[model samples]
Target chain A: MRRAFTEELQFISDQLVEMTRLTSTALDRATTALLTADLELAEAVISADDTIDLVRRDLDSRAVDVLARQQPVATDLRQLVMAMRMSSDLERMGDLARHVAKLTRLRYPHKVLRGPLEPMFTRMAEVAEDLVAEAGRIIANNDVEAVPQLLVTDDEMDELHREVFRTLLADDWGHGVEAAIDATLLSRYYERFGDHAVSIAQRVVYLVTGEWPEEDLHIEERMDVSRVEPLG
Target chain B: MRRAFTEELQFISDQLVEMTRLTSTALDRATTALLTADLELAEAVISADDTIDLVRRDLDSRAVDVLARQQPVATDLRQLVMAMRMSSDLERMGDLARHVAKLTRLRYPHKVLRGPLEPMFTRMAEVAEDLVAEAGRIIANNDVEAVPQLLVTDDEMDELHREVFRTLLADDWGHGVEAAIDATLLSRYYERFGDHAVSIAQRVVYLVTGEWPEEDLHIEERMDVSRVEPLG
Candidate 1:
């Protein structure tokens, strides 16, 4: 029974890594669709999101089953809870990727990436993909050391997100309101994709260290700095 | 021991209801701060978010304890798991409200909403507050019947969110790109607030029915229709 429980736990971990890989692939294909106006690829990413969701639901039920049957306490219990949280973060990352695909489909034959913003979206997508790939590695290997690197990647995504906004809000921005809205929403989707990756990494950190990432940073400081200004 | 476990479950439920109430208050004050540009109220909402976080952490630990000690299975296990999910949704709702407050503070002394968008924001806030309040009642009373009403409120919020976008994209839109970006982010915050409330209510629905809301509606149809276009 103990060995079976151990195998169940291993299965859950493997499932999370698989989910992360799917999310990364979805983001990659979605970005490709966004850049190249590939309707087929966009549709593929949109449809593939259901697979990620199904994986999350399966992992969740498995985790719950382990909790019920194993009656795990302490570290074991934490791992089960963290698995649920990681699955949620990864699932949300998948949803964000789907959002990107939907945007690609919405614009269709017309590319959503207009002038000046194209490179930023490209960089955002690259960062998002790297972040999810790293997230998968962390989950698969239980590598706490790789967690900080994910934060740095997220920072890069954040910088790119800001650059997208700067171009949109620039005095010379000629993309008009529709394009601006598209850019705004698309940048946000990519940014949030990075954010969910970071969140999953944080969960791994907590799982390993039993300390929340928020404890290392002031709560106020942890709030999306890009979204708010320093209080007077 | 069974009695103790039952009380622990009740306590966790109470904590969730309390968290819901706090989130509703946060949204209310955040909306007030946004509408009035009341820096003090904005700061109050910002600072109050920490209390909600602390409550969530406490509730999480307690739920973990219940799971570990009681080793609850079947329906009881489901209820505890659902409580944790609800607490998380409430905490996120608080964070969304804080996002609203942060935007208010970011644009302090100058209002974020201007022109025709003003009344729309006001209505969105009211809808958000009402949805969260209903979520709290659902948690406290275990009122699954009220879940559908929350969805109606969410629909109202979705309409307001679309209206905000329409005004932003209108040819007559006098608001500059900066204001448009702010409006975009702000509307999203409120929409997400509604989403989280609906999520909590769905958890309640699941707890009562042992059936996910998705099973009631087509999963693809349930995916945020406002964000995506129908696949051709």
Candidate 2:
């Protein structure tokens, strides 16, 4: 019975890892589509989100059922709950990626407006990539040590986002009305993606330490965004 | 036992309503502070976030515990899960409000540049104010019917956000540098606040429908954001 229960717990972990992988891929594809204006890629991301959403619901229902059936005790219980909550976060990430893809497929040509936003998007993609990988790694190994660093990645994502806003607001490069809105919304999606990553990391800490961190410290992003100004 | 459980749930519901009410006030306070450059008000909002965060965390943990202990079946289970998720949304709402407070507190002394953004922010505040109240009302009564209309409010928020970007990209309304970055970030924060509100409504749908909406209109919001650029 214990072995069967452990396998069930492992299955939940596997599902979380799958969602994290898909979310990261979606982010990557969305950025690629946005940078290259690949409508096909954008459409693909949009359609793919349906699958991710379906998996999320299926996994959540599965987690709840496991709770009902197994009555997960101690660490097992925490892991199951973590899976449930993280599914929402992962699903949101998929949604953010789809938004990026929509930007790629948007009727307005983003290439018309030249700005540093592409670089910012690239950096955001890298950070998101690392975050999803770390999330999967943590779940795979149940690593507590990595959770602290995920917070740092989230901070970095915020800084890049702030830079994107500063660039758009720059007198030399206003990113136009179309570009400005795209940049604004795009930056927000990435920032939120980071927040969910932070949420995943926080859950890891709780699971491992069995003590919720006293300080969220996740919100203490470095640098005052107000200090940021036009790069040019 | 059932009566006692109902009473406990009632107290929890009261706390949720009270939290939503105070946080909406906090949102207004933060926005007002941002618009008026009221450092005192901004500071108050920032400090108040602590209390809101505490309540949010306590409620979330308690909800999970209650669900685990009581093993609420059917409607009871759904309600408990919904509370857990909504409290998380409320916590994020608090964060967004505090973010606006940071903007207000940080951007002090730099007078807001009069541009198209001011109107956008005004509209956004109006929409956000109404939606925030609506979320509380829906939660208080568990009214699923009200969610569809609230979903439209999220769409309007997107429209205003797009308008702000269009203005930023506008060639005529260039406001130089200092006030522009502040304005851009300010609008972005408002947009994000709206996103959190939409997330809350989505959870309400999930609570009622027992699944994520077939059409995730909110996720694609930023995807279509670049489409509203003013024609030359």
lDDT of 1 by residue, B1-232 (tens): 8899889988898888888789989989999888999999999998999899889989999999889888999989999888888887888888888888888888879988889988899898889889888988998888999987888887788778777877887789987877887887788888888888888888888898898986433233333523522222
lDDT (Cα atoms) of all candidates against the true structure: 0.82, 0.73
Residue A166 of model 2, lDDT score: 67
Deviation of model 1 at A91, angstroms? 0.6
Q: Rate residue B114 of model 2 by lDDT.
A: 66
CAPRI class of candidate 2: acceptable
Model 2 Cα lDDT, one tens digit per residue, A33-125: 877877788899988998898888789788777766666555776677678888988988898888777666764354422567778788888
Which regions of candidate 1 deviate over 4 angstroms? A214-232, B215-232
* Top DockQ model: 1
Instruction: Specify the poorest-scoring 10-residue window by lDDT in model 2 chain B.
Output: B223-232
After superposition, the stretches of candidate 2 with alpha carbons farther than 4 Å from their true spots are A1-4, A107-117, A152-159, A162-181, A214-232, B152-155, B177-181, B205-232
